[model samples]
Target: MTGKTTFEIFLATVPGLEAVLCDEVRHKGFRSPSVVPGGVTIRGGWPEVWRANLWVRGTSRVLARIDSFHVTHLAQLDHRARQVAWADILRPEVPFRVEATCATSRIYHAGAAAERITRAIHETIGAPHADNDDGVLVRARFDQNVCTLSVDTSGDLLHRRGHKEAVNRAPIRETMASLFLRQCGYSGQEPVVDPLCGSGTFILEAAEIAARLNPGRSRHFAFEKLATFDAEAWERMRTVKSERIPSVRFYGSDRDEGAVAMSEANAARAGITDFVTFARATISELQPPEGPVGLVIANPPYGTRIGDKKSLIPLYRALGQTLLARFSGWRVGIVTTESGLAHATGLPFLPPPAPVPHGGLRVTLFQTAPLP
Candidate 1:
């Protein structure tokens, strides 16, 4: 499809960071972006959908609202699904999976709905089916008996970024790291440091943002597999403008040599090795890079994810003291499940927003303005 028509484009993210994602989408030039419960929504066409999948970070996935109708029963759903112009979007040769959700609707059985949609696709589109969540994902949702159909444009989550072959334990997700960086008022203009960098997620995100690199540059998307995909147009979209040399730098340090190596390798894969620095150093050995201070963001080991709570007190205390003694003007953003650990940092944090669901645990980003 050409980029003229308008449609609903949904950008999903971790629940608590919807507002942050909304800001990013709006700032990234998405038209009329609005914050929803779990994500943000805008009205755009197929080209917008592809651009969103390519440029926007902090989103878990991108979905395009392909069609919708009112269906009260399984038969109605099946008939409506078959009538949809599937050939316009889905490929007859590609594999597909249908995921259904029902809420306060007469057709309350999601499984039955999914089966009906699957049969419809098989019968009308002549596409093979996949059991796992792979390739094209057709999302069918019923709310008050109003069924809406959407296609997952992003095959894998955006955080994967097609890089980072190695990782440390309980590493922060790239999506969450980008949102946390935005929460700390980072906009790719200032330097960023992560003393407890694990797999260098935050540092890499900061470096990419500063360098104006597209998050989807090295990755492929489900949209390319769809019948609606236009290869020539996509090539134009993939060609990003000049990658301006960023004036600022990103620094990351970890106590584990393996983590440092992992960060270095990941940075090299991302093609931003010149703008990033990774080293092995404990929190006490952490020192600010030369020049103006910026932001210090860390995903330290929380008790539930690593060790016991009591055993982590000294780590938090030491981190706080070292920051106070060395990095006075820099701001801090820490992701932790427990409030006590954040409070132990002794940084003047403003009131935090609601906790976000992460790895089956509720986590929050505690941030401070430029330190006094």
Candidate 2:
């Protein structure tokens, strides 16, 4: 623990957004990172973890690499776990939890694996382990006979920013929204309109980003309780010089009254109510305030839950027509779980990008240029 240690920072991404997420990380100044199927790993320390949590717009969670070794059996796992210098990383006063997942490994029992790891920490390092309200979580990923250990620095998933009290059916996560926005080349410079905005996630994220607000500003991080926690350093890092007033570049709309109300409240809580305008409007009635060129990012219904496929086709067609008629010269980004549904839009859009796994479903982000 004396010399500088190489720690792995895990950046989780939506399935198709791995490349986009990787590009975002690199563009944000991360050095020499490797991308995996679901995420990317970068070499860094606690400071890097803090920076990722604050600045990474597309990542769902940021985990710190702790230790990794091959364990073919439970005894080997227990031995290796006990051998790890947990005391050097975790403080004795902070409570922690162990969550393990085993695949194709000799130690396939997840419950037993977790228990063994927890016991090792308690007996070897004198750390407090609990089943609930654990500030830190030890994640075990066992695959191909290799077991990797990571510490969860992000307590709640980054999408749960603790601001939204209400969410509509099939609500999009803030991380996914942010990723879609970035995929559309959103730089917080032009107007963004989400016609089918459910619960206002996309609009709210856009508004916050435009205002230069840190996504994790109002939340508490697990790293705060670590032994190496520096309160003063964290406070200085969180402060950014920006105006409190909202800009006029963000807008959202939904046909559901309740969804609109919830979005407005959520935006107000994030201090961007004056900048974001949410109204009850359908795709056919949607219109941008001033529209030469901007971005229209929307998460439309996939018709998997309540609506029939045939009836929903018209809605998609109408959306396509509306975008073609009123939003010419603008850029459009559409996210949906069904590619067939997206095709119904009938816009001269590019082929859907790689599908991203979300909430047990595969989602594709489709982009289109303004109609001429």
How close is each model in CA RMSD to the real structure?
Answer: 1.7, 2.1
Q: What TM-score does candidate 2 reach?
A: 0.93
Model 1: per-residue Cα lDDT over 139-221, one tens digit each: 99899989989999999888889888888887788888889899999998999999999899999999999999998899999
Clashes of each: 0, 1
User: Candidate 2: where are CA atoms >4 Å away?
Assistant: 242-248, 305-307
> Which digits, one per residue and each the tens of the lDDT, describe model 2 over residues 89-190?
788877888998988988899999899999998888677887596558889988888888888888888888878778998788998888888888887778
Task: Tell me model 2's lDDT, rounded to 2 decimals.
Answer: 0.82
TM-score of 1: 0.97
What's the TM-score of every candidate structure? Answer: 0.97, 0.93
lDDT of 1 at 48: 93
